[model samples]
Target: MTRTTSALVVESAGAEPQLALVTLDSLRVNGVLVEMYVTGVCHTDLGCMEGYLPVQFPNVFGHEGAGVVLETGNGVTDL
Candidate 1:
């Protein structure tokens, strides 16, 4: 299968956030493979942007998300 690198990444310190369409690293999860199509912006993300919450530099900020399952891990039975 093909893989792509992408993230809603920040560039520099205190820079305006931009949509970064980047090639993603090969990542694996020990469960159902979730292929995300649309992810919603949460208040926490805004907090990171506005310097309210302390976040790591160049943070990939998106939690409330929805996606499709692509693969399953070992011992996975439910679908």
Candidate 2:
């Protein structure tokens, strides 16, 4: 099943961040799906949005976050 979620995406340099809808198809063998409760945007995110940092467009920022594990993929033993 495909899972859909909303995220803050930087579409381009010098552009405002956008609320984007994203879809997840499957997880890696050792990956776990997370349901984020709180997220924080840092200086890196700002730099990326302002073109100071080299990054691909439509990238998801906010590395500082807290979340709960919703599902674990195959071969994942510890939760």
Candidate 3:
């Protein structure tokens, strides 16, 4: 089975262009959930997307993001 996740890509803050995609994964965490509502892009996203600041590549870069609890980890009890 394949799970699709929407993520924000940080290319550069003011230089690199960011992107969003749903990638494939093998393992999953417990506290991990999906953001079903609409997520808005902000200036901070631009900075990260454009690589204006140093950021990890091919990683979710949404800090001010909004989502719901989809799955819980092994020790996660508070939903």
The RMSD of every model to the true structure, in order and in angstroms, is 3.0, 1.5, 3.6
TM-score of 1: 0.63
Per-residue lDDT for 1-79 in model 3, tens only? 3567655554434434345667656335544555556566677666666767666765454455567756655766666
lDDT (Cα, 0-100) at 5 in candidate 1: 57
15-70: candidate 1 lDDT, tens digit per residue: 77777776644444456657788888788788786678887777776778889887
lDDT of 2 by residue, 1-79 (tens): 7789998777889888788899987888898899998989899888988899899997888878899889898999986
How many backbone clashes does every candidate have? Answer: 4, 0, 20
User: TM-score for all predictions?
Assistant: 0.63, 0.85, 0.53
Candidate 2 segments whose C-alpha is farther than 4 A from its true place: none
Give the range where candidate 2 is weakest over 10 consecutive residues by summed lDDT: 8-17
- Candidates 2 and 3 compared by TM-score, better number: 2
Task: Give the distance in Å from residue 55's predicted Cα in candidate 2 to where it truly belongs.
Answer: 1.0
